[model samples]
Target: MPSFTVVTTAQRYEAIVETGALARLSEFLPSPAAKVFVVTTEDVWQLHGSTVASALSGRSWHRLLFPGGEARKRLSSVEALAEEMVSLGGDRSSIVVAFGGGIVNDLGGFLAAIFMRGVPVVQVPTTLLAQVDAAVGGKTGANLTSGKNLVGAFHQPLVVLTDPSVLHTLPEREYRAGLFEVIKHGIIASEPLFRLMQLERPSVLARDPAAMQQMIAESVRIKSEVVSADEKEGGLRRILNFGHTVGHAFEAETSYTRFLHGEAVGLGMKAAAHLSRLTGRLDAPTCQDILDVVDAYGPFPTLDGIQTENLFARLVNDKKSILGRVHFVLATRIGATEVAAGLAPELIREAIASTLR
Candidate 1:
């Protein structure tokens, strides 16, 4: 297994990226373990339940089904899962296995954070998006009516297991859409990672094991480095939200039903790249390069009928906003970014207008 260690003030854990990580779950579980709660959605359970069951055969465990979707990412779900855990005779020693995609990882991690005042969670992310981003970061939360991830905690997982082979089961659009996040890693820190995605679309889209592992491993390294430096999103971590500000607005306006999170992020990146150019932080050629990768990744759902003004206004509610000024991570070049606050309203207007229409 190819692994990286993430160290934070609160905890340290390994993120393992390998072809058969599912078989290795037992190896990473806490020794002298008590009960285990496997939190996952029915769809994922149906596909991989047997594999997981076999791997954890000797352990005492119960499967907790989460109706997975952005709409279901709520405090209600967290509470319901907790209630289930208590009914199952769970206690502080009972560990949670968050075994699903990004949404379940976030929801389950939050569940473990609060259940018995924070039991351990081992994240086994099943989707491409979850593998590269959500699984590695200890940031766990659910959506709020006011904004995305408004209520959450920095409860690190005991470990994270990412098996790239599982991505073969992902839907075509979903798998490709998730690349926007991998692209985010590249743009924020590594030009080579960006170039790999840019140049290897065919191999990546084909799910070539080499291409997939390389993309996933490198993404984990970047995420581990960033999270290790700033676990709480207090400073350097803000760059991880490179395209999320505008992207989240699209999700809210559509009520989280229309686009996958990454699809919305793809649009958000377009707007951010344009904003970078408009702000004179990034040159035209570089801006176009960023735009080209976003466009290449997308025929993102048409932004028509969705008001850019509404999207622009939604920025104030972004968790990144302080008082009312939206802080944006602007690309100075591929593999580099600078955080900017209090962007001019006039420029914000143009950035949204340019991509959202």
Candidate 2:
């Protein structure tokens, strides 16, 4: 088990990233909880629910299961879970333990934040995507029918426990999907990490748990640093959304059925790089290098079939757009990214073509 910690002004929590963490919950939870609720999916509960339940053998426990998928990260789902908790006699002091990936963490965390006004929640992230990115930020939300993450709250988890061992059960596509965010973190903060992905031979990551743990720790540290500086995304926190502007649009445009979040973001970063080159922010060689890294990871969903015009129309509706201009997060090069606000629609369209071409 690899251990990691997140330090924030509100509080500090430790994440134990290994197998059997669910079995160790008795030692991890805070005292004086009236009841414990595990928010999860049926599949997740089927796989490891008994172990978790066994760990809390002496305590009163309730389980809330939702169908597992990105599409379920909605306000209705949040309301359903909240209603279930209320029906189960949840109180302000009750604890919610989210036991799945980013979708569960986001939905469950948001529900815990609003149910009874507020309640303490624990995050047990089971996927690589959640372990490194979404679960750490305390940026919890549910997608509205109109847009992704449209209804949400900023509620930090009382604690987070990550078990990388759980990732072994993840589908290959989903596992590789997470590498995109890992690569994104490297590009934004640590040059060494960026270079590691660039220089290492293919398949090196498969044999290297220590390397993976180190990368996750560094990425978490970068995130913690950013959150510490700007908890509410007033300034530095926006940097964390590096590829999200275009990426989210791509996800929404496809209705999230075709590309996983990280896969779409990987392509989005590539598209943003093309835009950066057109604006002279990045040279062609630098753009190719980043694209090469993404390609080396393989399995990028094609943008050729997606209608660029419709994609741009979707971009115009992005939450980041303000005053009739879309803001793009662009990189001058790997290891450096910036927000280019108020980009004209024409330029934004051109950038997408150049990067996705």
Candidate 3:
């Protein structure tokens, strides 16, 4: 098993990544809790619920299903899940097993945090995206109509169990979407990781076990180290939001319907690279290096129908923005980034426009 510990001021937890790791769920949660709620989506449950149920066969557990897809990740879903927990006799000692992709992880984590002033959560992320990014960080929340993750909280989980085997069932589009985060990790912190990604592209897309495992493990390690240093996104951790500032705005402007989260982030990375070049922080060659890696993984969402003004309007509401100024993360090089604040809105618009061209 490949595992790492994420230490934050609030709590410390281990993220376990390996094939068939889901079968060892009981070992991870040794305590006999009052009850356990396994929150997931109907699609995911249909595929792997039996295995999950078998893992917790002898325990007091219940499976709670939510509608799948980004559209259903809303505050109302959180409220409903909380209500379900209460009706099922949940208490402070209960545990929440967030057992799907990012949406379930966010919803379940938020539910555990506020259900009874917080309960322990165990993240069992199914999709590649969830395992690599969303599940590791304590950032949890449902989206509001206004923006993505605009209503989330910083609630760490008791443990995060990532079974790489589950990813074999992931659709190619979703798997590729998850790869964007791994590429982002490489671009933001590790040149070696970036080269590895470039080398392993075929095996990664083929879902080769060793290749997939290494990608997931390395990505998690990078995220764990960053979260440990700045768990709350106050400083160094903000770099992890590399393409998210604009990526998230794209999601919101399109009503979360047009692209998967990773696809949007892919487009955002292109815009960020363009901005980096335009501002002279990164030369054209390095900027193209970043763009080439992003384009390699993308048939990214088109910006044809999306308006720059609408994107700018949504950008203003980004959590990273403050006092009418957006805090943008721009790469100085392939493996480095810096936060640029108070960038004129026109500069961002022009960068986005370049993407359309």
Candidate 4:
């Protein structure tokens, strides 16, 4: 029953984090809806749908399975899911229960935002990455061939329910990928949190319930505060995109198949740290400290053949970039970051070359 509220100018929503919280889904979705659409992947449904089904036995609901993986996160998928919802009698009163990892949350949230001129959504995040990052933020959208999340809306969910127990079924690599966000949270705002990860890396990876719960709560709190203050990525919120500038570029260059989102961000952080040192924004010791934490999460996917120039091409296409200027988020030190604007492409290229080597 550990819960917190994300307060925004538009509305405030609650996020519940606990073991076995999925069983209490009814409590959150109390109002009767025309229909409840559970949007998830086939593999996830096969593994955990029954539990969710049993919990919603008294309610009228149907499950919609989308193809898993980043490849399927497209406008086509959103159109297909919306068509299915309409076929299933979904309307403005329908509820979309996003029930998987980040992809599911992003797609479901986007679907909810557009279906019947917008509907409500509840995020039941199953992966650590989703629980701590994607599930909380109201950011939702499908990726275009040009860039990630190029077409999306800032539609907030009604509630976010995280059951840490579902994380037990996650593969080790996936779990490790999720930790990159937790590490990012620490680097941006919580030194003690960063130190805790350094001290208890083994226990955290083992998914010790107590450690996991605390880590998830803390990460959510940090993000909740940031999102509350800057709901639309106008100002302070850009800090959350610490590793995303280059990270999104890497994903686009590789076609989102080579590395997980968090894995790419992990590499992006390494590059950002190098740029931070090269620009004298962060000292050598702090830069190494950042790299040490990132290395602990490795061995990360290498960018052996990917050209730095190609990465810069993708980087400029990022939605955050504007009018030929890239708003690069660089670390000032552990627990702090600053957005460097008008950075030349060559400097970013140098940083990428330095880190990827």
Candidate 5:
């Protein structure tokens, strides 16, 4: 096994990712003395919660199940979870185990960060997106009527346990949605990882457990390295948001129902790539190269006509925007990325249009 480490001031922990880590979460958590609670989606609970409970068969465990999807990452759910923990006699020593995908991890992490001012939290990420992105960084938040992840806080995890075997349960579209992040990590950081992704056959990504583990581990390493250098998203940390600017807007415009995070990001990256090419920062071939990788996974729905206009309006409201100008994350080339602010709205509209074609 290749020993990898991402050292950061934000307390870090090793992830023993394998087929059965969910059952072993009790051992991975701090101790049985601490008041423990789990927050997960009903779907995830039905699929693997019992096995996880069985793992801690001899211990006391509290669970709160919520509806699945980005829609549930809200203040109401957080409020409910806070009440749940409080009713369980939770104190400062309590811990919230996030036991689902990004929505659960983000909300649970934020809840753990704020409830009782602060408490330790464990992340048992069951999806590829959570294993690589959401679970690694301390950044946690929820959506609002204005935008997605508009309400959130930054609270690091006590530990992140990744079980690749759980990924097998992901729907085909969901699994393909996560590949966008795997491609993004390579685009922003490691050249070797990028090349490996380019050479991967569909069968390998779909069926090879060892390959899946390595992919998740390497993607986590990229995000962890960046987060370690700038824990609070100062300077170099923003590079991780390469495709998120427009990605979030696409998510919000659809009310987060049409596309998953990765799928929206896949389209957003293509828009960013087109902007790069139009602005002469990247060659036409580079734009096509980015599209090739994104298109390889699955067909993304078109965002055209009035929806395109609406997405641009949503961008204006994005937290990253300032003084009515949007800060767009674009690429200088296939393996390079750049951020530009005060971009013309007309140009932004044009970029969004290109993706639909």
Candidate 6:
């Protein structure tokens, strides 16, 4: 198993990436855990419930299922799940296993963070997107009607277990959408990674066992380094949101139905690259390269019915914005980025509009 510990000011946790990591779930739980609550979606639980049951064969455990979708990623779900946990004798000693994709990880982590004032959580991210991005960061949240992740917390997990083998059963589109976050990691910290992803597009998209395990570890390493240095997205961590300002807008405007998170992010990366070039921070060649790779990984859902003005305007509600000014994480080169605040709306709008066409 390839694993690393993410050190933070308050606590430290390990992220393990391996083919059969989940079967060893018992080895990671804390001693004297009064109850184990596995928060997952019906779709995921149906697929992997038996494996989990076997791993936790002798433990006191329970399952809490939510219908999976962006539409169900709300505070209400957290509240409902929390109430169920309470009814089932959950207490401070209860530990949460967030055993699904991004939305489940976010909701489950938020559930753990708030239940009994706080509890430990083990993030067992099943999807490629959650494995690399959402599961590691400790940034947990639910969406408000106005925008994505509007209500959230910074409760770090006890550990993260990422099993890439499960992805073989993942729907094709979901798996592909997850790759965009890996690309975002490449854009954030490693040109070498970016080049490898572009060069080995075939194997990567094919989900070759060797290639995927390596990619997951490297991407997790990059995220761990950033999170360890700036756990709260204050300075260096802001680069992690490279394409999300516009990406979240796409999700919000579409009522979270038009595009998957990573699909919206794929489109957002193009817009960010355009803004990078338009603002003179990035040269045309690199900007074109960014856009090209994003497209190579994507035939993202068409921006057909997405209103340009409304989508453009939604950027203001992004969590990254400050005092009503939008801040964009723009790539200065393939591996590096700079966060720009208060860029002109017309320029931002132009960048977003460019993607729609």
TM-score of 6: 0.94
Q: Distance (Å) between predicted and true CA of 197, model 4?
A: 1.8
TM-score of each: 0.95, 0.90, 0.93, 0.94, 0.90, 0.94
User: lDDT per model, in order?
Assistant: 0.90, 0.79, 0.87, 0.87, 0.79, 0.90
RMSD of 1: 1.6
Task: Write model 1 residue lDDT over 206-294, tens digit each, in one string.
Answer: 89999999999999999999999988888998889999889888887898878888988888888899999999999999888888888
- Over 4 Å off, model 2: 1-10, 15-20, 201-208, 343-347
- Candidate 4's C-alpha lDDT? 0.87
Task: Please identify model 5 stretches exceeding 4 Å from their true place.
Answer: 1-10, 304-310, 344-347
- lDDT comparing candidate 1 with the true structure: 0.90
List where candidate 1 sits over 4 angstroms from the true fold. none
Report the Cα lDDT for residue 17, model 2.
58
| Higher-scoring candidate on TM-score, 2 or 3 | 3
Candidate 5 clashes between residue pairs 3 or more apart in a chain or in different chains = 141-152
Q: Kindly list the per-residue Cα lDDT of model 4 for residues 11-121, writing each as its tens digit.
A: 799888889989878778857655899999988888888889988888989999999777789999999999999898887888999999999999999999999889999
lDDT for each residue of candidate 2 in 105-131, tens digit (9 for 90 to 100):
998899888989988788988777888
For model 2 the TM-score comes to 0.90
* Candidate 2: C-alpha RMSD after superposition: 2.5
**TM-score (C-alpha, index-matched) for candidate 1:** 0.95
TM-score of 4: 0.94
Lowest summed lDDT window (length 10), candidate 6: 312-321
Error of 3 at 93 (Å): 1.9
Cα miss at 138, model 3 (Å)?
1.3
Q: Cα deviation in Å at residue 124, candidate 2?
A: 0.8
